[model samples]
Target: MAKDMLNAVKDRLWQWLSSDPGFILNHCERILFMNEYREIERQSSALEKMQLLLKIIIEKGDDSCQSFVDILRIHQAHYWQLQQFFKPNTQGSSSPTVVADGGSVVTAREMENIRAKSINMKIETVSGAGGSQCGNSTGQNPQADYIATGGSVICADKICNTSTDGDFNLSVTVKASTQVCPGLVDETLPSSQEPAVKMIRQHKEKLVDCLRSDCSFILQRAQVKELVTDRQYQNLKDISQSEQTVIDLIDRLMSNGQKSCTLFIEVLKEPEVLRTYPQLKDISWC
Candidate 1:
């Protein structure tokens, strides 16, 4: 029964992570830009929830789930650092403000604060799992070792003895950052004025071909094949959609009378777009 409960929690977390397109896009943008502390905090909260679920799974889940837990651990480590980056610098100031360190500029006390907050928080567990639904154990914090050494906290044996009944609610509640459209140039450049048109044209075709190849490869995968039998049709549709998105972005940049190939490459590398079609990473736009 415990094993089944853990599996259900794992499945729900996986579904939440995979099904939210906007969340994934936002997450990618946060990782790429490293700005927006609010978004980082939102993501950090979600990661904390997942970390709790993972701990539960490790304690009672099947051996197969171990590999998935290991992968999640890597993500947890990454977000841990990000959480520290965005952690409020309240040690010296009366007003709470996020620490926007562009580089490695954190103090030792700040690091300790991050570690404490991560380990000391209480994560509400999935209810009706036939066990205690809180994370506190023996009225003693189970995070002393982790806090001292700055190591990963072990939550397997720490079970909270409280009762709460509800579905596992891990949704992040934060307003998304405002979206700004790229400025379009009023005057169009003549063919003679654009020196890299030929190069761009060739690069565009190469990108489209790569997108089609990636679509084909995705359709051929065993997991995808089981869900969709019309592989050829799906592959074509995916390829067309990816190609159009890339072409549209490039066209917008070029229409702005932008001459720099490097700028065009950077726009294409935006996290929102790149998260959807990672195959473009292989292209040498320069």
Candidate 2:
């Protein structure tokens, strides 16, 4: 049974391993013993090194296939991206999950899901009032080593925390839902109900003047984020004054047909842009 499993696994994995020799050899060097790796490294070509790496893992037996997988995941090997072909996670009871010997094992895939869920949450600032998930406010900030004024709030794995440094300390309690609890929302805060682009175009005149000094700054950022193209960036740069730069940017966005003006509006709210243009804080939508 084991021999058949080994041959099947080897034949299936070989094509993926052999597809990129340098990639396989690079990862193998980290997994294989240094002395043994040096001999493999001395092999004339990447194909030879990969072949030998597979041979070494095969000789070590079935458990080593899982070890090989664990290491590939460790180095973030490219094979994992071909999930359609490499479905290790769906192996059921045949493949074992390895737990590292030491402290907690950190995986990027888990962290990515956590961050993805948190990004859509909008943490609007209010009067520094108490926001406890349990609905009990002591009317005083909690005794803590540090405090946060405000920035972003993250809700993950039933815990919510503010990445803040200014306002009174808040302690949000547990809930399995991926949203910021409705209690934290301040209903009275000024916000627009209209689509962001429509709201932006409605206030274009005011925004242009407000954004004058920051045109070059906003342009560089907008281009970097791909909201504006290379040609637009260069053309805007050649224009003499900050006011014209702002004007041309709006005109291009209006003509581009992507309704990308909202993206420009979003760029104004970015943390880096806010440092230069804090007035943008006034632009918010529901």
Candidate 3:
């Protein structure tokens, strides 16, 4: 069964790859759009492609095909390594002490001393106020800190915190590069809504500008087309009216034969006189 599956898979891949010269071209656009989702699409797509190759081997049913399968199997062992960055809640533990081979040791005190050495650490100005998710990092709570002053909020500050739970004393230095949470957004704080609302208003302004520009461009193009079409219609109408006038004049002259005969003789005599006077023939019609 596995052999059949592998053979089928390989055939499918070969077919897809060979089907169109432009198939790979379409994937370039997908790769660009995938950037918005923070590269998750890229990782998942790679895994799927690898799995398809495995299916191809099972369908082949030959001992020689096992070589490719074995190679893939080896590569699969490092799946966790590739997936580590995308894994959630894998941030390093805040606990000071971890259990060693024989006994438990305190690392929390040591970490605090590390924080006390201002000479070693750099100062940064954090923008946001309270506890919330940082831009690319899972967020830590600001109020949970014990110290709230000087842009340095110690995680031990929250009222709910207990002593030496190891979760406490996770001090954060609000550096200039740090992504700040706007504030604590609870029922009690009216100020929490300000930043969110302001952001919405800004977005609305941008949308309005884009829409206006698009409308202006469309209106200008439409006006030009309308002007050209209107001019063409008026010109055609004028030409048709002038042709009708000529037809009417011709019909009148034909109906009145005597009058038409007199006018034709007069016109013929005038051209003959002009021919006799060479200077008159060359003169302006007006």
Candidate 4:
């Protein structure tokens, strides 16, 4: 029957997607702590392991597996960016760590979704559930809109489309702090050096924490529908070079301003850049 064939096709799609190679690599990366590799050789080995696992996963040709592969590939690309730090051939001014602008910086919701998918990806590899299997949260809500007719279907787990019906809760938090500038010998008392380095370290930690928290809150408050307003979506879909540059420039300026905000006494006392950039709340580059 047509309905039976459609169901079979969908099951095949889900199986392939669930075992996505990229998704599997992410799981391996986390489980093996490949992220901790300090040398190029070690890192290369890690990459090799990842590649092998991915190849095997892809060959399986299941929908869920393919989905896993796609997710893993994305995470692996991120790992590749980190590998530059380990390249042995690169010389001069080498440090133990490399710092970049850091990506969109995932929101808590996104973070949870990634984490949930990661666990599920790993379980899929072991279970070999083949047809379809659901474990861990994917941050998708079962309550999400669905269409159905008069029919009854169930899985061995006694659940229908359980994998698609999940929800994630990401709460927001904020904190405030103040500290004297570090490395400063009070102009009035040149002998005062006790607070310099200590204050600087404290400030740096506080600044990073504050920025992370604010960014998370902003992302949570953002509404995708509002941001992708139909008109804007069309324009964004076909953005011009000039438009892209303007967007990039604005983002850099925004980050720069926030980075320096810690230098401002009042801003440091109670940081609030997110309040101004509410659009950042729900938008993700991916």
Q: Which candidate leads in lDDT? A: 2
* Per-residue lDDT of model 1, residues 1-286, tens digit only: 4345446565445434432222332223212222221223233234443444444335634553554443444444332322232344445553332221111111122112121112322323222122221221222222111121111122222224333343422222222223222231323334324546445656767656654434444333312323222432343344346555344333323332335344545545767446656777776656
Ranking by lDDT: 2, 1, 3, 4
Q: Model 3 reaches what TM-score against the true structure?
A: 0.15
CA lDDT of each candidate?
0.36, 0.51, 0.31, 0.29
Cα-based lDDT at residue 8, candidate 2: 65
The TM-score values for the models, in the order shown, are 0.20, 0.31, 0.15, 0.15
Model 4: residues >4 Å from true position, as ranges? Answer: 1-44, 73-286
Model 3: per-residue Cα lDDT at residue 201 = 30
Location of the lowest summed lDDT over 10 successive residues in candidate 4: 101-110
Better of 1 and 2 by TM-score: 2
lDDT of model 3 at position 231: 30
Please give, for residues 60-110, the per-residue lDDT of candidate 4 as tens digits: 456535454344345433334222222445334322222211111111111
| Location of the lowest summed lDDT over 10 successive residues in candidate 1 | 143-152
